[model samples]
Target: MAAENQHQVPPPPGLIASLAGLAKNCLHLLLSRLELAAIELTEVRDTLLQLSIVFAIAMLAAWFAIAFGTATLIYLCWEAMGWKILALLAGLFAVLAVALVLWGRSLVRQGKLGLSSTMAELKSDRDMLL
Candidate 1:
C-alpha cells in the first residue's frame, strides 16, 4: 500500500521558483505598509511643526504690540502732557479699578462668572464622581 501511494517529488527548479515568487510577494507587501506608515508620520510631523510656528509668531506679535502701545502711551502722557495730567490719570485708574471690582462681584453673584472658589468646588465634585 505505501509503495502504491508514493508520489514523485517536484523538480528542484519548480520548488525554487515557487519560493522566490512567494518571497517577492511578501517583500512587496512589507514595503507598501512601511511606505504608508512613513507618509502618515511625515504628515503628522509637518502639521505639528506648522501649528507650533504659528503659535510662536502670534505670541511674539502680541508681546510686541503690548510693549509698543505701553511705551507710546507713557511717552504721550509724560512728555506730551504736563505733570498735572498724571494726577488725573491716577484718579481715573483708581475709579476704574473700583468699578471693575464691583462689576466682577456682581457677575459672580449672578452666576455669570466662576470665581476661584467656585472653580475649586466644581473640580472637587467632578473628581468625586470620576
Candidate 2:
C-alpha cells in the first residue's frame, strides 16, 4: 500500500490534453461537414424541383411542336413519297428517341447528380487523416 501511494504520480499532462483537443477538433470537423452536406442537400432538392418543373414544361411544348411538325411533314410528303415517308420518319424518330435515352442513361451512370463538393471534401479529409 505504501509502494502504491509512492507510485501515484500523475500521467503526462501534454499527451492527455492533446488527445482531448484532437477529439474536440475531430468532432468540430464532423459537425461542419455534416452542416455542409445538409446545405448541399437542400440546394440539390431545390434544383431538382426546379428542373422537374422546367422539364415538364419543355416536354409539353415539345409534344405540341412534334405533333404539328409531324402533321405538316406528312402532309407535304404524302403526294411524292407516299407511305414510305411515314415509315422513314417513324424510324428516324425512333432512332432519335433511342439516342436521347442512351445519353440520359449515360449521364445518370456518370453520377452527374451526386454531391461533388461534399464528396471531394470528405475524400480530402480521409486522406489527411490517413
Best by lDDT: 2
Residue 44's C-alpha lDDT in candidate 2? 84
Candidate 2, residues 28-69: lDDT per residue as tens digits?
A: 999999998999899889989999999999999999998999
Residue 23 in model 2: shift from native, Å?
2.0
lDDT of every predicted structure (CA atoms): 0.69, 0.93
Q: Rate residue 25 of model 2 by lDDT.
A: 99
Q: What TM-score would you give candidate 2 relative to the actual structure?
A: 0.78
lDDT of 1: 0.69
Clashing pairs in 1: none
- Candidate 2 residue pairs in clash (backbone atoms < 3 Å): none
The TM-score, computed over Cα atoms with residue i paired to residue i, of candidate 1 is 0.36
Taking the tens digit of each residue's C-alpha lDDT, what string does model 1 give over 59-82? 799769856865676678886677
Which candidate tops TM-score? 2
Can you tell me which runs of candidate 2 are displaced by over 4 Å?
1-17, 109-111
